[model samples]
Target: MATCAAPSESDAPGHPDRSRDDRWAASGAQLRALVDAFRSEPVTPARTLQFEHDVQIVVRELGRQVVPFRYNQVEPAAAVDQPRHARFEHETYTRVHAKTRQNVWTVFGQLVVRRIGDRPSQAGEPMLFPRAHRLGLVHGASPALAARACQLLAAAGANQQQILARLRADHGVGWGVKKWRPVSRAVSDEMGVYRHDAQVDQLRTWLAAAGASTGRHKPVVCVGRDGITLRLRMKRGSLYEVASTSTVRVYDRRGTRLGTVYLAYAPEPGRPAMRGALTAVIRDVLTRWEGPVPRWCDVTDTGDNETGYDDRVLRRMTHPRTGAALAWVRVVDYYHASERVWALANMLFGDNARAVGWAKTMLTWLLLPGGVNRVLHSAAAFRAARTLTRVQKKEYDRAYAYLRNRMSHIDYATYRRVGVPLGSGGTEAACKTVFIQRLKLRGMRWAKDGAQTILNLRVVFLSGIWDVVYGRVLAARPQPIMGGHVAAEPNELEIAA
Candidate 1:
């Protein structure tokens, strides 16, 4: 994970008296020695677990040794000349320290940097450190470390404590909550700056590939949305919040899904941000498609948010270039519709062996052509054959109406025959991956920012654009120091897995 900064000489820690030439020469020799030591080590220690563990520690040590040699070489973003007055919107700031020492965290651990600073003459005004911001430090963590911590935070079954533990064990980096929280929060926020564009670009490529692909049927593009209840950090009398996950997928003609783009919103009223994000990408792809459009379909349960996203956003979208409406085959997820039938079966035959037999028959019928209608008819016939309690009749009618009303959506046989999707597996998988797997772990409660810190990383990783998007973020660091009018842009740093 090398940064793109140009090499420059700086005195090494504990050797500040050394000349610039002496420092560079010593660093070069030290780096070469570390490289030789690395080559002497075994490449693969998998045969012996102990050897593998030993090799990992050795590699980490080599990487640690290399950090200062390169990090100190990153050209400092300090202001030139001794001109002092600085205007920010309205107030004026003055140079406070010609150079100040600060600790910066990195994957190799911490490094002390001497950066110039600025502050308002008024008491209580906080000093600003421009070099850190220009170099894309997330608070105190370097760009690479910030990127690493964010990816680690997305581990499927790991909670906050476990995440920090893994960071220490796997990477030999120490991180405590007070230091880690703000760094990750800043990185997640930085990731948001490039989220929409990166995903849109990803989806465009997928759509183009899917359209050009030759197959038995048109390439299938799936639209999915689902929601879950997340336990929030005990706040002013609210224990739960609703979070939503949405996905867009493209499949080749043979019904093989090529890839998927995922979007998750922690909690917002109507999730307008999420809605606008999806609308932008989906609309862009449909409008600019070079040839035939993929067979677009929506797969979701009849939940309010799921159906609402379809009805309002995805259902009858109009292409910007062409005035014609974009079409989507809205299918109710077969698995969910199956549950509705099973509900009726339970009501029709409570706690009896007959219930299993009836529900199994209905579940199978759901896959046949016009299966939902048969399910309704069969349930009615069963009720007619036996006298039911008052409550039983009420529950039966309720369940029957749910299936009856969504008759148009539960055409699994037709969907199967045509090779359209019958389940919202992508969306369900996303809910688990983005929300349930990490956020809903036992005894976990999250603040809005805390939740977004993890959700932002999860969405980017699951969309398969971590490397692309994060690089763009690190490249777009804030410009100019607090007291200076101009400064060179920091080099782009790319993070790789």
Candidate 2:
């Protein structure tokens, strides 16, 4: 590296030639004396013109050694000038990355003209990439070449630190550094499409802005669910099926209603497990229920197997604020598709765990017309239908009256028009959509906290401020660039370093 220089004067000791002017002055008198002495030298007879005649005669006897010089003589040749073709010069280039190249014959032409016409003249065509045929610069997908290109682009678009961070944090992106010879080399785009800090920042900013906008709004009534499921690993010492819970939150926004998140933890219709887990799920459903307030809540066991009792179910009543017995019962098959059975069980047990016995009533119910079945004794229409067989509809007479009695008070038909809570399925769907979509990858073995973080992200996503909330959370994290400054919007300038 060059350093600042201090001003100084030249210094030489005992120099033979101090300067050209000094040497010339000192040699002038000597040159003159030598010239005069040489001019006064002898004009000897031995070196006179008389010696040349004998030498000329001797040369005639010996052949002269003439050089074989071959050169074209420039004869004007009487100026018979014929027309010559115009001399044109051109060059071509071959390249692999042709997308980044262009042929510009006009550019070359314009450049030549510009160079020749330093004197101002505008009587030529404007410069451009013309449609004339020429050589192309090709660019191949060599890994090294691509990497170099990426580096160049990155240097132009972003910075070194940004490029490095993307390589480390974002495996999806195509870029990183590798060792070359004795030194480390940065290879851009060596990876795939990795997330850049700018993109992440932009998303975070958008979310923050959205959150700030909606923070003032009232909390819309959101019904959510949480469920648990168990997995058994038979190979490494077998284990029993454990019950896992997933919680879902359902809400309405504008006109669009979302069902569930794709590939998320959801409560299945008939997965068998301990009754305690079921009770917890039912309890959550009751707590989160928002629409169509019911007089009483009910819990029932609806699984395939009954390895355990169902007494653990808990129900809460609203009007009189009272707690009732957690019901339990035995069933031939706990998994029944009948909505009436479900309704009856809910009404009778009122969130009690003991409603399992009603499965017997399900088996005895008579199939009615119009795809709806009613109990022979409970619903009177089936009893009054005389065309039905006596043995088939044993309690047909009582069934119609019972149906009329319930229908008169319940107005079950009108329930369809109004938005009312039917079951906790909405919240259950929420669990499947929001939680499982993010956490459950095919081979992912997540620690509790990692799973929770994903779940938290899911919640924020569903909560309508995922982008904003994630930014806030990421801002708090020391792993990413962090600061106490209020979260920035997408268009906000970067914080000063």
Candidate 3:
């Protein structure tokens, strides 16, 4: 078996040039200083505060001093070799500046580097620093700090002010909303790339497992979809307009939610667009299955377009590679159907005790075997017996049409017996957890791209995949540059430090 060796003192930042013995002597001196400081003060709240302050000062000072040394150790030398391309001759980069100073914000506080810079022979090109560029330190903040900020905003659902406050309080890193906002936006903007990369990775892993014959029987998959309204600012007016966010939650046989995906856009994408979005989500989930393909169940409310789309678009969808159609079982949400029944009862017999009793009776009939037929017959009979007003007549007609249309999907008895869910409670709860809890705060109005970006991050965070997505986003960041050249590595350095 192969074993990995631990990093030595020379491999660590700030200690690269120092021998192990010298490092030990320095550590002893620092420990003694700390001990002497503690001995100089009694155990009081004021002394505790003083100690903390001193530690902060020492850490920041160390960071400032060591960052330059670390940068120099790995800085590309003058006239470095370059790869040859088909159309261009091989070239080398020359040192442009012996030393150039740049400041970067980091978890350890602001670190300044004054180091040698390199540049390509070509004119009008940018400078580069191999170590700093590799460390993702050429921008406003280090990639690590940007990633930390993204985590705070995405997972914590914190506003700019809250993120700033927490970073200062917990990490001793001071930053304003102005500095934090762009970092977050830059991270969120890569949502498309992150999502695509993740899906591809998942599919590749699944395919590998299946090829190795290590796949297990697939579990039952339940899909719940619903929509929630968002208040967004209007271009023409001071007031905001209502926009809808569609959400889909997938769960395994054991009722453990696998993931939740969301689509929130303005001007409401028509039925076709909405259906396409849903189809992509379903396909992505089903494609990663191993062994037997799982059965699917869609639990949703009785919206005309939503039901039609599921039946026509989602149920008919086939695997692009396997050509297997999804075995989808449709279900109308029990509560929504019951609400229609109650509304019919109230319209026919006012909102008194009689209406309540009639509604309860109809609901009971709706749940029993052959109950949909009985409920329809009873509703028709009640309408015939009572002389309804024009408005009440319209309500009666709507109730009859609603049940008649969804009669095929309302098999509550079999669903109850087989453990299939009858209601879209999961979807309802998802609306609150995925979107409302974060986006529906007071005075929160979002621009189109901003809303979509945050929604993407929110879903990724809620689905327990924020780390994966964020890592991809960090990896996809533009290559760092220094003094007029693309930084090339002589050998890999510890960028994480």
Model 2, runs deviating above 4 Å? 1-418, 434-450, 474-497
lDDT of each: 0.74, 0.29, 0.62
Best candidate, TM-score-wise? Answer: 1
Give the candidate order by descending lDDT.
1, 3, 2
lDDT of 1 by residue, 349-465 (tens): 886889999999999988988898888899988888878788888888888988899999888887876668899999899988889888888878888778888888889988999
TM-score of each candidate?
A: 0.81, 0.28, 0.76
Tens digits of per-residue lDDT for model 3 on 1-497? 11111211122343344533454466557657876988886788877776776666555445444544455446532323222111112434465435565666666566555445556677786655544546665255777777677667765355667777777655556677677667667767776557644643443343344334422323334566666666666787444444444555443444444545555443354545446555676676566554456556788886666667776777678876599666777889999889889988888789899999988998998889988888888888888889988888898888778888888899998776555678888778876776667766666776766676676666666655667776776676555333344545634432332
State which candidate has the highest lDDT. Answer: 1
Off by over 4 Å in 1: 1-66, 73-97, 118-130, 170-172, 235-238, 349-355, 481-497
State model 2's lDDT. Answer: 0.29
Which model is ahead, 2 or 3, in terms of lDDT? 3
